[model samples]
Target: MSHKRSFVRRTAAVVAAGAAAFVLAACGGDGNGDGSAGHGGHNATASPSASASASQGQHNAADVAFAKGMIPHHRQAVEMAGLAPGRAQSAEVKKLAADIKKAQDPEIRTLSGWLTSWGEEVPAEGAMDHSVHGMGGMMTDEEMTELENASGKAFDTAFMELMIKHHEGAVEMAKTEQADGAHGPATKLAGEIITSQSAEIERMNELLGKD
Candidate 1:
């Protein structure tokens, strides 16, 4: 009876030690000393995806439309600007065209990038006919063709007038964005466009010697 009791006591001691060792090993591996890794890891992994989802979701339809529409509009402006270097006669006209190209080219890329990041469709060059876009102040196809064919002082005059109208259209779009857009960067760009192009519009009018 005494021998059997000794064997039982030793076996129970070994079992307890083994259990304690297992618990310690698990705690060391988990690093938290708590049985929380499973839940904690799942939450941590899900956080970034949730954040990205929320960020992408913040933009509204107006924001998407603005980015899509502005790209082609800015492209047409750049195309018009490219004509001025060789065809325009006035120094001021040439400089203004260069400035427009320099400023708006990067903005086109910026808008395109934003649209792409948002999973929205980006408008390519010639994506829409300006005349049919129903956008304010966009030049007609005939108007663009006429400007392209013009040269010397005629080119300068046509470029300025067309650009003024184009900038006006951009301002209108930007104003809409400012009022209705939900994306922060897009709204900020809209405000900058309003300020910059409004000034440019005034300058172009001054160049044309018009009120």
Candidate 2:
């Protein structure tokens, strides 16, 4: 009788221990469906995501200024190029204008998108004052009007001269961006602008017989 009582007591204690362990195991799940611990639970950290990391990449005031200033600058160039189709004397001039429009339009959209992603205002969307944003190769209203009114060889001469000036201004702005801008894409675009626009300037010079 004594032996049986002792065996019964040991069995009862073992069953109690088993029940406690089962309860602990059941409560240990993190509820994230992965059966992990402390994840998606109270101990999860407030860490930033990969996308947030990408967006936090280097950028500064010069980068911002480059984008803001260039959008309207490019817009004006596109407008000028649009005028060249009907007014230009030479087929070469017309093609040059078309090329400028083709290249700069997409670039304008790219710059605007970057600014929007950065939580900055896109220029020429009624956000920026035109006077302030005319920092790069932008023409004033009077100069634009002069181009608008001219035709034939006069239009060709004026377009070449004004476009040279415009290209020079863009080169200057791009050099500043290379020196001061922090964002990689902005700096890259600046370098490209310098290369392509400098070449265009040379081409225009050739067209003007200045080369």
Candidate 3:
């Protein structure tokens, strides 16, 4: 009878041990699952926060000035270029005008986008007026008016002269941006402006027999 009682007690202890081990394994699985979920949640939250910080922190005052100033400066150039197709005599002059318009219009849009994203005010559509003429390469109201009224070889000559002056101003402004701007994209755009406008300046000088 004592042997029978000992056997029963041993069987009960074995069953109890097995249940404890099963419970521990289930608890460990739950712990691991929770840990994995926590890590995933942290990563998801961190990514956009880091991206927002990068976007917001990347630009500085010089970059803002570059974008704001360039917008209106480019607008005036586009306005000047627009007058060429109807008025210019030389095919080369007309082609140059078209190229100027094509290039500057997109840049104006990009500058405006940057300003908007940075919570800065974009220049108004009429902002290309004489109020901005003090900016590099911008023409006065009278000069734009004169360009509008000219045609044929006269228009070509006037266009080249005015555009050369305008391009020189743009190059100077771009150099300033390159030196002072903190934004990567803005400084890169400034570099591009210096290269392209410098080339255009040389081309226009050749056209005017001033090279």
Please give, for residues 1-211, the per-residue lDDT of candidate 1 as tens digits.
9999999999999999999999888878777633354457766767888887786667888999898888888888888899888899988888899999999999999999988887877776677564435576666778878998999988988888888889999999999999998888899999999999999899999989942
Measured against the true structure, the TM-scores of the candidates, in listed sequence, are 0.71, 0.70, 0.73
* CA lDDT for candidate 1: 0.85
Better of 1 and 3 by TM-score: 3
Which candidate achieves the best lDDT against the true structure? Answer: 3
Q: What TM value does model 2 have?
A: 0.70
lDDT of candidates 1 onward, in order: 0.85, 0.82, 0.89
Per-residue alpha-carbon lDDT of candidate 3 for residues 100-154, written as tens digits (9 for 90 to 100):
9989999999999999988999999978765687679688888889999999999
| Model 3 collision count | 0
Candidates sorted on lDDT, descending: 3, 1, 2
lDDT for residue 138 in candidate 3, whole number 0-100: 85
Ranking of predictions according to TM-score:
3, 1, 2
| Per-residue error (Å), model 1, residue 150 | 0.8
Which segments of model 1 are wrong by more than 4 Å?
1-57, 130-134
Backbone N/Cα/C clashes per model? 0, 0, 0
